[model samples]
Target: MIQWIIPLAFICAGIIAGLIGEKVIFKKLKTFVTEKEVPGSDIIFQALHRMTFVWFVLAGFFWAILGSPVRPDIANAFQKILTIIFLYSVTLVLARLTSGFVNLLVRRTEGVPTSLLSNLAKIAVLILGTLILLQTVGVQITPIVTTLGIGGLAVGLALQDTLANLFSGFYLVISQQVRTGDYVKLDDGNQGYITDINWRNTTIREISNNVIIVPNSKLASAIFTNYHLPAKEITLTLNVGVSYDSDLELVERVTVEVAKEVMQEIAPELIANEPYMRFHTFNDFSIDYTLYMRVSEFFDQRIGKHLLVKKLHKRYHQEGIQIPFPIRDINLHGN
Candidate 1:
């Protein structure tokens, strides 16, 4: 009964100490998280909430058991159990921290997602922790490692498609050719903003809000144009035709004025230093020329075209600039 009393007291004391430490650490962490507002503060707070008191209690429990008089075999078994729990807890904590850090990084980087990498990191941590635990408890892992090595080649062959996609995803991530928020067009006429690249597919969101999922392996091999690269700004040309009788100088002046107005009102930042037109062709109907302007990106070109056409037509109407249509003259001879 006396022996039992001492052990019971020690165990209770350990639990109480753990609870106290938990509250104290949590309070401090809360303050720090609130004050600092770091990227992974929530993850750190949760980790501390679980680990701080649990570790203290585990330590106290171990101390209590060691201090009590017990058989050597029982003591050894208890110590092994404690060691396994400690290892498991440490692995869990590390995995969470790693995943949190990765999530933070994902937010900072473009075109990178965290789910796949975070899960992979956690799995790796658990596998390593399991192996270490097994070794600690007198289980040999060399045989298991050898077996995995031998089977890896067969597994690789069986999962050829899956492996290809996985490697392609890795390559896409490293290349940075296509990135989030950038507009891209595939050779087959599919165009959209790249949203994410996961283990098997890359997600692109089109202007219509529809998502296009292309296999990572295919995306890696496909020839595509990235409009956001080199620069986000793009040049757009609008072909216009004025009647041959109209004055070319007046036409250029009116067109340039309207373009400058559009630039200032619609896409001031996107337009190039100058808006100009070139008289390039003479047809049977009207003189053909091309109006050149710049836009912020692919999407902006649509708005650019709309505004320029509307304003140019209105201004042309006011200035009496004649836009001609194709006309054919039919003549007949009588004998």
Candidate 2:
């Protein structure tokens, strides 16, 4: 009974310490982090939450094991196991911390994929931690590394497609040709905004709210147009035909006025490059030309066109400008 008191006391102490650390210390730290608005406070708290209590409990158990009346060999073995567990937990926390920070950094920079780089950072930390853990347990690393090098070749050969996608994802990120938030139209006619480029695939979200998952290798090699690159501004051309007898100068002035009004409403920033038109073709019944207007982005063209057509049609009516319909006259001679 007397011998058990020390071990029992240690166990009780561990529980108490764990409760205090988790309930009191964690709450205070979280409050501080929130109040300070630290750059990575959310990440730090997320990685460390619930871990404090476990660590304190583990520490208590380790001391209790040392004070217990157990065989020397058995005690040493238990201590070793506890050390491994503690080290592994620490490794997990470190991995999370590194991964979160990497993602935050990538988000701050333009044209970099957050998921891909952050995942890679986490993987690297985990691999390093694993190697350290193995060495701590008296396992020789040289032979293991040599084996992995030889086996890696075989694995790489077997996973050719997987490797291709992985490398292609890296290329996409580094090239910066295609980036998240860019509106792209693929060769296959699939148009969407890029959401993310992960290890295996790139995610695109269409205007219709449908998602497209294209493999990294395919996306990298595929012919695509990135409307956001070079510039987000694009010219929207509307082909219009008016009655042949209509006054050309009046038509141009009225059409341009309507276009400018619509553009100002839809995208005011593009007003510097005012809307214009040029007569291009003469038909039997009407004169055809293109009215060119500027829009902010690819998606804005829909609303811009809608507004422009409504305003142009109303203004044309008020100006007595007639939009003639296709008509053909036939002459028949009886022989």
Candidate 3:
């Protein structure tokens, strides 16, 4: 009964210490962590909460061993086991904390690749921590490092395409030539808004509700037009044709007026710019001209064009202007 009571008392003490950690220490720590709102700190605190009980148990274990009549060899072995557990737990916590913090930083940052970097950071921390832990447990690391070094060359050769994509992705992000939310069209006609750049491929979302997955290497090498760069403001041209008999001055005046109104109503941002028209050529049926206009961006042009055409058609009919279609006349002298 006495033997059982001694172990029970240690266990009970551990439980009480765990309760204190939760009620007192954790409460204070929680307040501090929440106030700071630091990226990845919450993850660290969560792991710490679970470890609190284990920590108390370790302390109780140490005290129990010191006070008991256990043999020297058994006690030393138990102590080693406890120390190893503590070290490994610390390693795991630090690794996760490091990775989580990097991820948080990436989300807040602009123009940086998040998922790839986050994963690389995690793998690096784990590898380094594993090496240290193995050394602590009396395992030599030199042989392992040498083995990896030899195998890496072979792995690189086997994964040439994958490595090409990975490096290209790195280059793309570093160069900042192409970026998220930019409307782009490739030379081969695959055009879309760049959505995200991942490890193996870049995700492009087209205006037609389709997605195009182009490999990073291919995207980097491809000649693509980024409408967002240089400037988002672009010039839009619309061709106009009225009957050859229509007044040229009146045509310009009415066309400009319609364009100005459309620009104002649909794209107020472009209203300040003056619209211009040039009579380029006299076609067989009508005089053809081009109307030059300004729009905010790629999508705004659609609205601008729609409004301008609709308004111009109605305005032209009201003014009795004729937009003649093609007409053909043939004279036969076969008699």
What are the runs in model 2 whose C-alpha is more than 4 Å off? 111-114, 330-335
> Mind giving the per-residue lDDT tens digits that candidate 2 earns over 13-112?
9889989998998989899979989889999888887789889888888888988999999988998898888888888899999998887777788744
Per-model TM against the reference: 0.77, 0.89, 0.70
Over 4 Å off, model 3: 1-114, 125-140, 270-274, 330-335
Model 1 scores a C-alpha lDDT of: 0.84
Total clashes for model 1: 0
lDDT of 3 at 257: 92
What lDDT tens digits, residue by residue, belong to model 3 across residues 208-253?
A: 9799999999999999998878777888899989998899999999
Model 2, residue pairs in steric clash = none
Supply the global lDDT for candidate 2. Answer: 0.90
Clashes of each: 0, 0, 0
**TM-score of predicted model 1?**
0.77
Worst 10 residues of 3 by lDDT: 106-115
Q: In terms of lDDT, which candidate is stronger, 1 or 2?
A: 2
lDDT of 1 by residue, 1-335 (tens): 68767777778887888887777767876887778877677877765566777787788778878878889899889988888888889888887877777766766775345355666677788888889889989989999999998899899999999899888887877687776678999989999998877778889999999999999899999999999898788877999999999999999999999988888876787555688999999988989999988777889788888999899889999999999988888999999
